[model samples]
Target: MPKKVVYLVVLVFFLLFHPPVFADITVVINELLPTPSSGNDWVELYNPSQNDIDVSGWILDDEGTSSDMLKIPDNTIIVKQSFKLFYVSNRLNKDGDTIYLNNGTSELDKYQYISSETDVSFGRYSDGSISWNTCSPTPESANSNCEVIVDPTPTPTPDPSPSSSASQSTSTKSPTPTPKATSTTTKSPSPTSAKLSPQVLSAASESSLILASSTSASTSPIPSMEATQSALSKTKVAGLLVGSGLALIGLSIGFYFWYHRVLGNPKKEQSENKT
Candidate 1:
């Protein structure tokens, strides 16, 4: 292969996989301590990109003529999203000054500020932001918190919970009893028995029927299981009502005797007076 074509092929391969030469120029003068209270004054460089940066010939300087600029060492590689620190001790003006970064040619970034407090460092918010703030010196690490531009993000509306499919149990309905095809003859009203009125006799007949139904219900071979239980319940209710009625009558008779015993009987007193 030709020499130029071979060289071109190698360059293209490295570029495709992100070699250091073609990395985007994203390095910024991140942090700097102008007024150092304890240690020497320092400046920090940061590369906030995924690809490594070859900041070999980059320059760091304050407001001075040609002789005062500091040149980065050759093959000085700053890995992605990392920091580099240089001790420009006593170089920065403690009162106030501007710091500049250059790629041996055009300027990369610069920061100008008024006088800084003692031991405080000024830098972009996180690393490469335009906004600057001051905090305790954080050399070769992140700057103190004032570089980022945060817009308020609205809280996402929570999705409505899906309605639960509640399983509603249908109530077991008591089935209506079907009538037989055979004719149902009404009993002819019979003469009153033992001075009982016809209405009372009719009621007595209905009571007898209810009792018979309840008694046979347990042993009766009914088709539906529910119908048998319903008949049994009806029988129990009728028995309870009859028992309550008898108890009420007994109580009424006992109360009549009690009243006569407690207070003197008016009829007996009248007869004694005549005597």
Candidate 2:
């Protein structure tokens, strides 16, 4: 009957149009390698999905600056539940540098680090689309308990003036009352000059130099403690969301099947008893 045909058509349409509950690829930044005083940085990518994903032709770039491009090899295939590490050739990006992952056409993920320090971002890629979240830079994401902390620079002390000792000594000398009687006599070179300590001057100069160096390092841009903490929070939330979504979807499917099995079997039994 036409009604049967219409029912079939509706079923077909529903099957075709329904959104899939499972994702194709899940990419996570598993690790950010140690940054040396100079040289390149590496980003580790993990494929958590069951199917293999070919990252060939994929590009990794640093934010708006496209000059630094990492190309995934044509033969590159991220096996199911495996990891791949991509090394970024660019050295320390000044401040506020962003690293982006793309597949020639669309951006897959983006991470921004406060300039001069090592920070990172991560995301997932599916069918040319990117699912991404920003994270505060971490020493490494795989190990959440461990973090990188930049030590505060020591404060500098002011250098003592050479004239201070001479002034102190002059102040201590008693004043002669007869001005004309002592005028013709040769004045003794102050004993204070010979008493001036070489060790004291050397120590003062060294302390002043150390302070100056510390001041310069302190002024250099380093991520604040609060900013680092914020970045970690963001990353943790993102990881939980990505890792939990599939598990939730699986649970939903299992519940749906159980519900149908329970109701359908009970209804069939009642129909047979009526017969």
Candidate 3:
């Protein structure tokens, strides 16, 4: 085998076995409703990964500015190939806007549109095509035809008459005197209610006594410091008396042994001298 051919085989094997690290899943903005009927705008993300991908620390930006970006919350996971709706707090431009989904320095996906319609979502068609258009906002679901969500609240019609002003003045004027007279009457009973407060104070005193007794029963008894000191002093006096008696007995036995050994008996010594 040629040396160059062996080297080529080894290089191919290494390339197949070892791949680059720091790999991340790609997510796209599947649908967006910039002009909703009554709330802040929302954007939906589509994760195509078979496993759940955590999009924590990801940023969604418009115009790629610091003030125009919304950082996704921590532990924000899109379950295996699912959709996640996020509120775009950066105020989506109703006329025309561009949204960019990025992680750190890497741009994952971007969607932009110029022709925006009110309450209509802009996204790709369901025919497996890459073309994006004004479709129904299917948040956390597949994109389809936009539905006309009618607001149930009736539009307030303005009364266009000089009497409308007169009626408002009459309504405002009628409420003023009624409350002041009622408030003065209501304040007189407050002192009467203060007489009832004594009953509440008695109840509170009873509860506090019960609490004190319960706490006292729960506590264990502790020895007094005076008792402990008296016990210690008695032990010391007993030890001292025993030690003094032992010393006196030892001294007497030692004195008798010294006299017999160092001084002779007088009668025995005189008998030995006569012999």
Candidate 4:
């Protein structure tokens, strides 16, 4: 009976003095949707701790002095390290606003914005991180990295002109070839024997006939002077031939006598003795 009372007192002290577990819950306002297309605006909450947290009786509001707030229903559980979305009855502002999340007793988290882009949300770049960025709307999920990609435009190339092509052809052309010098050779004449005419006989002829003709009439004698001249020329030619022949005969007789004188003539001596 004594041990039971002491155990009861220890239980009461632990129950009363220990701080409430719900107050230490870690829940953050991760993403916000200020402008909606056709429904009430909403805010997403995330519990980053390892265990599930009870967010019942939690309050979400914008501009602390206004009536734009949402009280969570009882028995609401935000799963550990997960996302939970809550609709806020068109409470957020498109251009600028401030938001708050509290456990009905103490403030848990707050966010402020100057402007929100259309069709997008304002949230932490990495979930549970203090750095904020404008990102695509991700309800009840992890936030996305903020990035923009743009396509580059292509540039066109210009076509070549006729004048430019002609200029290039002219620049690459070869020079004209020079003509070579030609040489000429001269030929010498060969020695040839000349042909003699009838008037200038080449062979020897001692005697020939002489004829005389008179173009004009002459009355001196029966024979003309030209005829007389011709007869005399003929006679002189005949006499020269006769002289040449007699000289040859005389040379022969002289040679015969000279031979007899050198050698004895026995036959001529015998004939002289008989006479």
Best TM-score among the predictions, by candidate number: 1
lDDT of 1 at 138: 80
Candidate 2 stretches with Cα past 4 Å from truth are 1-25, 91-94, 116-144, 147-275
Instruction: Please report, as a residue range, the 10-residue window in candidate 3 with the lowest summed lDDT.
Output: 17-26
Reference-based lDDT, each prediction: 0.79, 0.62, 0.76, 0.79
Indicate which candidate wins on lDDT.
1
Cα lDDT for residue 212, model 1?
Answer: 93
lDDT of 4 by residue, 1-275 (tens): 99999999999998786544764447889888888676878899998887777888889988846563899999898878899999988788788889999888888899988776666788886888877877888999888866432234788888966798798888789566789864322243334332333354533221221112232334355888999999999999999999999999999999999988767677778889999
For residues 78-150, write the lDDT of model 2, one tens digit per residue.
Answer: 7767778776765435555566666677676666655444444332332112333333433322333333434
Cα lDDT over the full model 4? 0.79
Residue 130, model 4: lDDT of: 79
> Ranking by lDDT, best first?
1, 4, 3, 2
Please provide the root mean square deviation of candidate 2 (C-alpha atoms, Å).
Answer: 42.4
Residue pair clashes in candidate 1: 125-147
lDDT of 3 by residue, 167-207 (tens): 88888878454454444545566665465555798998999
Ranking by TM-score: 1, 4, 3, 2
Model 4 weakest lDDT span, ten residues long: 204-213
* Residue-level lDDT tens digits of model 1 in 80-198: 99999988867888777888888877887888876878877788885777777776678888776553334458999999764544222222354668997753233455444555766
lDDT of 3 at 244: 93
Stretches of candidate 1 off by over 4 Å are 1-12, 16-24, 145-275
